[model samples]
Target: MSSAGVGCLYGVGVGPGDPELLTLKAVRVLKAAPIIFTPQATGSKDSLALMVARNYVDESRQRLIYASFVMGGTSDGVWSEAAERIAGYLLGGEDVAFLTQGDPLLYGSFMYVMVKVQAAHPTIPIEVVPGVTSITASASRAKMPLVSHGERLAVLPAMYGIDDLRDVLARNDTVVLMKVNRRAMAAVSQLEADGELSRCVFVRRATTPREQIAFSLREIAPEDIDYFSMLILSGKKGQV
Candidate 1:
């Protein structure tokens, strides 16, 4: 389904907060793409993806576009509309570089937009540029190895049930709890009850200037509740 001159869409993962962590391939795509698309959480004018890649983007020659989505979820046809707009650009023969905070295929808003775009324009070529994931960055920043020597590693959402989380801690050598939002305190409480809070490594804005890392739940402050945070539970030598 290749069109004569249809432009290829690029999903560029900007990396986890730290601009310097951005890959060379990602920077190249950002610089070459004519249109840059950044996702913004509803009610937030700032786009974290743009912030991370601002230094690399040729803002003077390139166009910047923001697509906002409700972090909780959206019933409105927001994704549909965004997809239409992106397809329109592609049909016009302009390459779009969709910037994402993390890897586009992993919990990135680009994933949703991707489904919509592909459904409408399957012929339009799309390339995903991989970047450093938050989980990997968190481990590196904390100097902790997530898994080694055939150890099991599991990642769960913050909204998972306490019973399920308990099972994860028991079954896996390392468990990562991603996107600790308003449930941050409750997650800590459950981990404390399960005696895994002590071994837990918590990080907010990993690899960024605002980064905060805590080894114990007791060390977490009230302001530490962030939707960008992640909790990693790993025992010594990668045994939970």
Candidate 2:
């Protein structure tokens, strides 16, 4: 990774919510990179990962590039427009670091960028730096382990349909459900009916100042949970 070798792309993970949980390597790459790109949903007012990185970034030097948008173009053409802007920086030979809230490759917006960049510039070297995901953070906070002897762990984004959710729960011993929001209540309820809810732990805004942990989903206030939450369910007793 020479400075002049077209300046590689780094998908650096900042960890789930906690700025301090960022790996030393992630920090080093972030600070050294001349261009730091953070993802923001097309209409979002603020970028959470960027806000967390701001706590460590040297404001005087590093240039901030807001790579705003989701994979699908918005009605206002904001998403495609934002992608083009980010592509411009990468094509300009800048060592760009695409920062994400959790491990960059794990359900992070970095995947969208990586795919776009690869299609546009096949020779570009993209590096991925792993960071602790929300599941691990939630587990640590709740003193729960996602894995135990003979226990299989499956991670599913709450975006799954009811059938899919039920199927996964029936198959896996331990499951970590992400992107939990109001829409996920039905699936959560199903988990209870399956006799797995009591073994579940819910962490909302894990690792941040607003962090909340609930041993049972029933204990969580309906108005409190949003997409930022994660649910960790353990299997049988003695599995941990």
Q: Top model by lDDT, which number? A: 1
Candidate 2 per-residue C-alpha lDDT over 101-165 given as tens digits, one digit per residue, 9 for 90 to 100: 88877887777777777877787778998988887888898888777799788987774566666
lDDT values of the candidates? 0.83, 0.76
Count the clashes in each prediction: 0, 0
Model 1 — TM-score against the truth? 0.91
lDDT of 1 at 30: 93
lDDT of 2 at 135: 79
Q: What lDDT tens digits, residue by residue, belong to model 1 across residues 1-240? A: 136789888999999999998999999999999999988888886998999999998889999988888775762487778888999999989999999987888887788778888988888898999989999999999998898998899987784566666667777788888987656457556667665543788888998999999877778876887788898885334323
**Model 1 regions lying over 4 Å from their true place:** 1-3, 182-184, 193-198, 235-240
- Best by TM-score, which number? 1
- TM-score: model 2 vs. ground truth: 0.85
The runs of at least 3 residues in candidate 2 whose Cα sits more than 4 Å from the true structure, single-residue gaps closed, are: 1-4, 42-44, 70-83, 159-164, 190-198, 234-240
